[model samples]
Structure formats: structure tokens, C-alpha cells
Target chain A: MSELEIAGCSKYYKKNGEPMCALAETDLHVKNGRFVSIIGPSGCGKSTLFNIIAGLIRPSGGHVLLDGKDITQESGHVGYMLQKDLLLPWRSILDNVIIGLEIRGVSKKQARERALPMLKNYGLGGFEYDHPDALSGGMRQRAGLIRTLLYDKDVILLDEPFGALDAQTRMQMQNWLLDIWKDFKKTVLFVTHDIDEAIYLSDEIHVFTHRPGRIKATIEVDLPRPRSEKTLMNDRFLTLKKELLLMLREEQVSSN
Target chain B: MSDQLKDNEPFIEDPSVRTTKLRRRAFVGQVLVGVIILFLWEFLTRLGWLDSYYWSSPSTIVRTGWKAITQGTLLQDLAYTSGSTILGFVSGTAAGYILGLSFWWSELYSRIFEPYMIAFNAIPKLALAPVLVIMFGIGFDSKVVLAFLMTIIVAAIAACSGVQSVDRDLEKMLVSLGAKRRHVFMKVVVPTTIPWIVSILKINISLALAGTIVGEFISSRQGIGRMILYAGQVLNIDLVWVGVVALSLLSIVMYLGTVWLEHVLMKGRAPKS
Candidate 1:
């Protein structure tokens, strides 16, 4: 059985008193413990879809299912990481990481105990008491990811989590993220505009059309696992990158 | 080559050393300015170019202050004034913050009350001092009520804005993590509003004092304002100057105390370097 399914979900808004579609009727399925990426042009409703999936907003039509049970319009079933590292400034790094557990009625003492080792494992051990401002950008992002991971949700949705980093840091984060994701093996659906990132991390890439976005194509990435810097120069990686770029360029030109 | 290299070395000073030097220079300048002003005042009054009777000399004002202190009247007046200010400030801020949180909790209450709050805030609170005096009588209650009236409006407005100004993304993140309304309020809303509350406390210190003094001016048996009024009426210019000086000192001390509290509360929340 599929772990998650989006069946004909859509969203509409009123602009100047006229109906406008933000997301068309869309269907997607993620098997348990697989990484999927959604790549699109700007303003293509990828975030809107993620918001629906996260239950922050309801779709205009259709349903989202988990384990073949309808979980649409309901929240707290998935972990979500936004583009910016939204760590609460006033909290210590350890306190921030355990917020999810705290909200779930766990005692702060117990939450701290559970979160301490995770912080050390993630390379943030000695800095647990430090403020978010004291951490580097990449470190802050890692803290944010740890916070989401500690939520213990079956599915995790990452919305351009590394978009704000410089290239070197972005590469480092991607490698670190893959290592963590491989170990955890949670159902992952990541959204980004970077085709290289999408190709590198995802088992399948879903290309989206411009505004009023719908799934334009779903291409399977057959690259071998344990992907690294060497994988970037592989012939298969170049071929997949070229194909995705051409598809994205075509969509951009047609929209313009 | 060594001489050339030494000459070419960049001029670097430790940041802490530079800061101390700047602070010392500023302190000297401030003291110098105060001394110059005092000397000019004494010189002008001694030469009879200025009316010493109406505008008492600094030395005479200081002597009167010493007499008031020695006689214990100054201490009594300071205690009474400060007591009213503190009582009113605490109660007013608590009530105002609770009211603001209620408004945040209920949209219907906010919509109905916001316009009235704006209109009430626009009215000059001093004009209402007489009414408060009449209602609460010529005791400590009247001064406290006046101070409460002066401070509550500002605190309510500040607290309301603070609650409303929380980052939407953070709220969403919490909601997605299974946080209920109470969790969100306790974790996100209250912590985010703390800086605003601290700032309003600083502002309320002066405003509460102003309100208390205004009440005392209208009708009060004891207080610095009443002291000033009585001294001026009796043509005791030196006593009046003493009252003014005491009030200025009280304001400075209160302002510095509030600044220290802000530094303590906002220690970890400061922006990244």
C-alpha cells in the first residue's frame, strides 16, 4: 500500500472578484520510505500543495490519504521544514529542537534527555545551550531539520530547506541530509527549483508547470544510492540533468 | 628594512580599549559642561545681572535641599510619590496586558472595542485628573488612579500590537507540529510579546510618574508636586528649585533601572553579530 496519496487535490482563489486557479486537480503517490522531489518555476503553487499536504490549508477539491485512510484537512500528521531556518530566537538550541516533543505533552526534562544525544549525533553537542544567533547559517538549518525530525512523524516535507545557503554550504547540507534521510528512511517529499538538487536527492522527480501548476512530468531517477560529489560527473547524472532542464525551459517559454 | 616594516604596520587598537577611551572622554565633556553652566549661573546672579530672588542660585537651592533632607520632609515626600507611582504602574500594566490578551483571543471583542480604545487614547489624560481626584478623594488612591489611567492605554496598545505581530510562519510551524491553541499561546505568543512589554514598562515609568504628579498638583496633602506648588505660592524660590531637582533625580534613577531590566530580559534575544 502507498504510504501517502494526493487524489485530485486542487486550490482556487478570488482575484479582483474573479475565480483563479492556483493548483489544478493533482494526483501523487509516495511509497513508504522513498524520497520524491517536486521541481517547478517560481509562483507555481508548489508551496500551496505542500501547505495542503501539511494540513495548514484545505484543498478546494479532493483528499489526501495515509495508509489508505483519508487524512485531508487535518494537521499534525507530517513534519514540515520551511525555506528559512525558523528557529525561535529566544530558545536555546536544545530547547528549540525539542519543541515538537514538548507540544506532544512530553515533560521538558524527558524531552531534553531524548533530544541531547540527537543534538550530539547531529554535530551540535556542545552548543546546545547557545542561542540560535550564535550558530552559522548551515548550523541553524541543521537545528531546524533536527527539530522537524524529532517530531516523529512518518512523512517529512522539506520546502527548499537549503535555498538560502551559499553553494559550498548547500552541497555540505545535501550530503548531510542524505546521510540522515538514509538512516531514518522516512517518506520524504522535497520541493525545490534547483534541478541538480532534485536529481541528486530524489528517487523520482516531479516537474511542475508554471502558475496554475500541475504535474507536467514524473521521471524516475535510477542513479545508484550513496550518491556523492563523484555522482555529479556521472554520465547518467548529466543526461538526467539535461532532460529536466530542457523540460523546464520549454515550460518557461510556453508560459511567457 | 625593519624600520620600513615597523612604519608600514597597520594601526590597530583593542576594541575594549577604544570603547573605554571614548567613554572617559564623554564623561569629562559632560562634567565640564555641567561645571561651566553652574559657574555662569552663579556668576550672573552674583553680578546682579540675573534676578536672584525669582531665579534662586544653585547654592541656595542645594542648601534648601539639605535642610529638607535633614528635617525628613524630603524623604517623606519622595516615599509617598514613589509609592503611588509603583502601585499604579504595576496594577495598570497587569490589567492592560490582560485586556490586550483578551482582545487577541477574541476577534469579536477586538473589533467592537478597538475604535473606542483609539478614541479614548486620543483624549488628554491630564484633563481627567480632576474627575479622578473627585472620585477617589485627596488621598493616595486618587494619585494612583490617575497614574493607572495614564499608563494602561499605552500598555494595552503595545501589548495588542505585540501579540498581533508574531511571525506567521512560526505560527504555522507550531500548528503543524500538533500544537493546540494553548500551546501556541504559551510558547510563541507570550515570549514574542515580552520585548514589547519591557519597552512599554520603560515608557510607563515616566508616564505613571507624570500622572501621579498631575494628580498631586490638583489636590494632594503630600508629594513633590504639592511641595513645589506650596513653595511657589509662598514665594520660596529656593524650595521650589529643590523640589524640581529631586524630581529630576527620581526620573533619572527610574529610567536607568528600567534600562537595566531591559538588558536582563533581552540578553539572548539580541540580533546576530
Candidate 2:
């Protein structure tokens, strides 16, 4: 039931009194429970496309349809996360996790009751009452992800959620994310410039082209799920990585 | 580090313990410096090396202070000055804070009023003491009004910066979670700005005191300012020194109280030691 569609989306920004193209006409569709990744070179407007879908910004030239409804320039239909955890330093980890619930009128007591178990089930068990500064970077990022998930949105848009982590932690987070995605059955649209990350996590990887980004290629990874570290060394995985790498390199050169 | 620890093992004092010791030593040194200055003044005056008529000695100052405390209107003057300062600071900061927070509700409103606020802030509030005393009259109200004038603009400016420094990305995060405009303000803007508002409390306290003193000097019959002014006119050097000492002690107490309040307001948010 959680399907998303972007129809003829385009974005424009005013730079020095001139209308500059940020995202060209674009169309994207994600069926229920599918995992999609958007990857491209720097300044290729991957984030612009991401924001348009998240409804944080308007597309200027098209509409964003979520669950078959026009949601262009609107927010709150989906959960969003960025590379930085953005946790309020004052609030406890448990409280931070339930911010969205509180915003939607959930009583504090009820929110705490619901979040306690989730916090325990995740690795943040006894650390619930501690402030964000007490947690490691990976733990903080995990808390951020939990916050996004607990928001209970049908679609989640993550813009480089693990981009700030070290290579080892990023690998662990990728596997952890897959488990959560499979268990929750929620549609996810992830954006990253890391080709390996794109191929490892997404069911379909949307490769974006140079500045004024448009979908350059859509590569479908048919590898079996319950994906693990072993999947990273698979022949198909390497092939997809090589292919995405080539496309992104072409875009990066043109952009520079 | 205990005496029981063997001296042969080079003792490493705990960091917190070392910090406490250093702070204690600094306080002792500060008090020692004050004692030396007072002792020298008293000794010099008794030896006739310093003129007692022009430069009152510590002993004379203390005697005058004690006499004023026990018989004169010292307590009443203390209450009046401190009352106006606290009243002015609280009211001015609250009013300006609310006014500044309202700006977040409308961009047009903030932009339209920004220049006016800046212009108002530029005026020396102390210079308006005579006008305020005339407007509010030579009573507690005049002193309170002056103190209010001194603090209001500064509080408003602090709050405006707090509003501007709000994390837009955090606002976006809240919006993505189905939060509305007021929700973003309460959940995001207010908590984020609390630190900013609290930071100005220390500054506003001193400003409020200055305004109160200035207003009292301009017209009021009470307050430490009036007491000092009367003593200067009458050539009561000891009383003037007593008034100066009392004011210093008063301001120190007020400043420490503000630090405590700031600590309380930031209870959960204060950075870990």
C-alpha cells in the first residue's frame, strides 16, 4: 500500500538573478516495500530530487504522488533522515527517539511506554536515559534511524544516513538496515554517492547524470535477500558496482 | 589523596579534587588581597600618612556601615535598590523575550521591526534617567522604569539572535514528522533558544542595577545611589565609602544568583563536566 510516484519532476534555483537548473524532468516509481537508491556525482542534484520526493521542497515543474495522492511541496507523508543525526543534545536518547510521536499528539507517558521496548530491542537498551553525547557516533546514528522508523511513515527517505560513519561501521549499518527493511516491509528511498552502498542496499539503483540531474540508468540487483557481508563479494555485486562506478565517473568528469 | 597513602608512590590527585583545591586557594588569595588593602588603608590613616577627611579608612567605613545598618535607613535603601533592579530585569527581559519570539511567527513583522529595535538599542538607556524619572516620578516606579529601559533592548536582541540561530534542518525534520507551524516553534525553536535567552541573564542583571542606580541618582529619595549622593554633598566621606562597599557586595550577590538561575534553567542541557 506504500507506493510512491514522481511525475515529470524538475527543480530550478535562482543564482545571480538567473534561473539555474538543479534537477531536470524526472520520473520515478517505487512499489510497495521496494528499496531504491539514488546515486550520482557531486552537484548532480541527487539531494534536490531527494528533497522533492520528501516534500521538503517543491519540484517547480511536476508533482510528487504518494499513495496515489498529490503531495508536491508538502511534508509529513514520509520520514526523512540526513547524514548528521540532528538529535537534540538536551533530550535523553529515549526522548529523542519519540519526538515524532510527541509532535503528532502522543502523550509523553504513552510515547515513553512505546519507545522503551524499541530502545531495549535495539542496542540502546540501558542507554535510553543518557544524552546523545554519551553515545558513540554509530550508536547516535542508530538512534536517529530508530527515530525515523518510529515515526511510523510508510515511506522513508534517507539522504546518506551512514555517509558520516567509518567504513567498518557503514558496512555493519548496511546489514542492520537490510534486516530492519525486511522486517518492517516499508518502502525506502536512499541517496548516496558510494556505489558499493547503492548496490549493497537497494533493490533498484537509480544512477543520476551530471549537473541538472536526470536518471542516467536504473540497475536492478536481483541478488537474493537476507543479504550479508558475503553478498559484497558476489560476482553480480562487483558487476553492478563496476557499472555504477563507470556511470558516476562519467557524470563527475562532465560536472567538473 | 589521603595521608594514609605511602609517600614513596608519587601521588596523583584526582582531577576533580585538584580543581576544588585550586578554586579554594584562589578564593583564599582573593580574600587575602582585600584584607591587605584594607589593613594598609587603616594603618596609613591612623599614622596620619593618609588624610582621614578625604580618604576614609576601613575602620571608619566599617563603623559608618554598622551604624547605618543598626540605626539609619540602610536596610530600607538596600531593599529599594535591589527591588527595583530585580523587578526591572525580570519584567524587561520577559517583555522583550516574548516580543522577539513573536517575530518568528511572521517574517514580514520581524523585518519591519528589526531596524526600529536596532535604533532603540543604540540609545544609551542611562541618558534617559532624567526623562524616565520625570515620566514615572521620583519613586520606586522611576527606578524600575529606568532599569527596565536598560535591559529590554538587550534581551530583545539576544532573543532575536536565538530565533535566527534556530536550526532550519531541525525544523525541516519536525515538519517531516507531521508537525505544524506552532509545533515547530514549541518543539524546535523554543528549546533551541532557551540557552540563548538564559545567557543574557547575567548581562541584564548588571544593566538593570546600573539603570536603578542612575535613576536613584537622578531623583529618587531612597536607594544606595541616593544615600551615596547625599553623603557626598554633606562631605560624609565614611558614609560614601560605606555605600560603595555595600553596592559592591550587593552586585556580587546578584551576579552569583544569576549564575545559579542560569544553571537551573539549563539543568538537563548543560554540557557534561
Q: Against the true structure, what is every candidate's RMSD? A: 2.8, 2.2
Q: Write the per-residue lDDT of candidate 1 for residues A99-129, one digit (tens) a residue.
A: 9999998999999999999999987989899
The pairs that clash in candidate 2 are none
Which ranges of candidate 1 are over 4 A from the true structure?
B1-13, B271-273
* Candidate DockQ scores, in order: 0.64, 0.65
Cα deviation of B14, candidate 2, in Å? 3.7
Please state the CAPRI-style docking class of candidate 1.
medium
Q: How far is candidate 2 from the true structure (C-alpha RMSD, Å)?
A: 2.2
Per-model chain B TM-scores are 0.91, 0.91
Most lDDT-accurate candidate: 1
**Model 2 stretches astray by more than 4 angstroms:** B1-13
> What is the fnat of model 1 with respect to the true interface contacts?
0.70
DockQ of candidate 1 relative to the true structure: 0.64
lDDT of 2 by residue, A6-58 (tens): 99999999999999999999999998999999988878888888788878888
TM-score of each: 0.94, 0.95
| Tens digits of lDDT, candidate 2, B1-273 | 474678588867679978998999999999999899989999999998998888889888888999999999998999899999999999999988988888899999999999999999999888878888888999999999888988898889888999999988888788888889999898888887788889899999999999999898998889999999999999898999989888888899999998999889888873841
